[model samples]
Target: MTLPGGDGPILTCEGIGLAFGRVQALLNMSFDVRRGEILSIIGPNGAGKTSVVNTITGFYRPQQGTIRFNGQDITGLPPHRVAKAGVARTFQNTELFAGLTVLDNLLAARHIFLRSNILSCAIYLGLAEREDIRARQVVEDIIDLLEMEAIRKQEVGTLPYGQRKRVELGRALALEPDLILLDEPTVGMNLEEKEDMVRFILDVSEEKGTTIVLVEHDMDIVMDISDRIVVFDFGVKIAEGPPAEIKKDERVIRAYLGEG
Candidate 1:
């Protein structure tokens, strides 16, 4: 897409290896996520795509290599700490309070800004009430931007799959993250739904200037949206380049696209 931020990478992952006992989930994986650009990681079914995201967000610890975000070494940081550092992630499967309304679900994601002590919250005093209003305002803007006004008060579980996925993206937006990791955002979506998601993702990157590291299996969409592409296979990175170069890579063809 010829987006900016070629100065340097915002997140640099080098030689990352993580395993569960004897089962290696990711091995010697490396890539760079540029600031304010979309970088998509694509591969076959058991290619350790999610493992890379989990390790970057501190859900899993890698036995080898280091991760640097915004020029700071953030390897092995806790998930909460990672969030505080402006890196957020969405799960491959939906992760939301199903019984809660969409608004409430988004409000819950605004916990970082809940600056109220027990006393102020208990009495609904100055600071607590002010924080509540501010949080609501922020979340409402996200709702509007995501075009989720109709279902703002609907219970999350009652929404259709596409809407639920949209809400999950909204929750991540509520965090006001500098970098967001999206895992399989459009897998089950129909063509129209996928188009809408692509628009939202592009809007978030261009308008808000947020960096995105996406894990998506849809080759067409990934090649269309991503500024850079990283291909993985059997717990290792196979190729890294822009979409055009990656499409013509011999190793990637043999390993991922299976055209060799």
Candidate 2:
């Protein structure tokens, strides 16, 4: 559905509720990821931050509420369908193909966009060659954007931890998603790596105009990169606003920083 924002949100989660047996994971979790904007979801560990991402991406179906993307109801859809709907995500852990070369991993991500028949690919037909070239061009572009051109030919497993994370980001971008969900994109990185991630995220939003939904624990990074922030605690939303407003929110302070 079109959000209150004029450009319309690329994603909207309304009254989202989920339960894992007796434990409530999320309740009435509502928010909008505005078109071409970065929306950060922040909370302490086990505050259902990742659950919100899973619910939106169809990894887990919410027992209540609706999720809409580009004005279409996407709730209950399968993960692949949600992905094909222009929503792409990266796991908190780098999920790269360990043995695959960086370029190969990126090509794998674009498999959904490939139309060549298996027989043609196996035989290396003219049509398959054309498809391969097109896919390679896309991968090359992502390499440049993510600054992985130098390592494109290297095996992903041989790359350092920070480079592997970048490869994961590249794989996600290869999906050509309109909205990208980043789950702790900078987690486990050094300060320099975190700075690079923050810069890249901002560049992606500004240059590519891709909407972003980020679940981040780094408050400084979140505050610096996000256009808006959503705070959650005990499975419920406590505050939602711009970075400045959220920083001053008492609920957010109590939930994250403890009583002060």
Candidate 3:
């Protein structure tokens, strides 16, 4: 797509291995996500696509290998620490707070950026008040960007599945992250919802200059949105390249596309 940020990768994973008991979820997995580019990880069901995301975000630590972000070694950092390091993610399943309003859920993500202490918050003045105001402004801007102004006050649990997914994305956006790992962002949405998500993802990349790591099963969407595609199978990386090259890769066609 001829995007910018040609300097180097924003995130790098090398020789990553993860195993749960006898099942190896990943094996010697390695890749680089260039700054300000959308990189898609595509594989069949149970191919450890989500496992890669979890490992990168620190939900699951790799038994071996290292993960680096922006020239810093972030391997094995806890999820909260990862968030604080300017990395954010949306889950394959929506992880919104069921009882909270959309606005509140989005604001909660800004907690990592809050500088006020408990005493200041209780006083409701000075730094605490200023931080609160700024946080709300960020949340409100996200709500407007995602077209969620109509449901800002609505409870998340009462919303439809598609809307809930959008809220999850909004919450991740609230982090103002440098890198965003999106696992199946449009998996269960209608065509229109998927289109909207693709648009928002592109906007986040182009307008905000955010680097994206997308794991999706929809080949059409993946091919359309991804600047580079990585294919995996049974915990092993089979191929990696631009969409057009990946489309005709023999190993990818055999292992992932289910063709001879």
TM-scores of the models, in the order given: 0.96, 0.96, 0.96
**What RMSD does each model have against the real structure?**
1.7, 2.2, 1.7
Candidate 1 per-residue C-alpha lDDT over 1-260 given as tens digits, one digit per residue, 9 for 90 to 100: 33557658889999999999999999888888888889999999999999999999999989999999998888999999998889988999989899999999999989997979899999996888899999999999999999999999999999999999999999999999989999999989999999999999998888788999999989999999998899999998889989999999998988888674
lDDT of 2 by residue, 29-121 (tens): 888888887889988889999998888889999999999999999999999999999999999988889999999999999989999998998
Measure candidate 2: CA RMSD: 2.2
Instruction: Identify the runs in model 1 with alpha carbons over 4 angstroms from their true place.
Output: 1-3
Question: Which ranking of candidates, highest TM-score first?
Answer: 3, 1, 2
- Local distance difference test values of all predictions, in order: 0.92, 0.89, 0.92
State residue 43's C-alpha deviation in candidate 1, in Å. Answer: 0.6
What would the per-residue lDDT of candidate 3 be over residues 1-260, giving only the tens digit for each residue?
33545768889999999999999999999999999899999988899999999999999999999999989999999999999898999998888899999999999999988988889889988998899899999999989888999999999999999899889999999999989999999988899999999999988888788899999988899999899999999999999999999989998998787664
Local distance difference test, candidate 3: 0.92
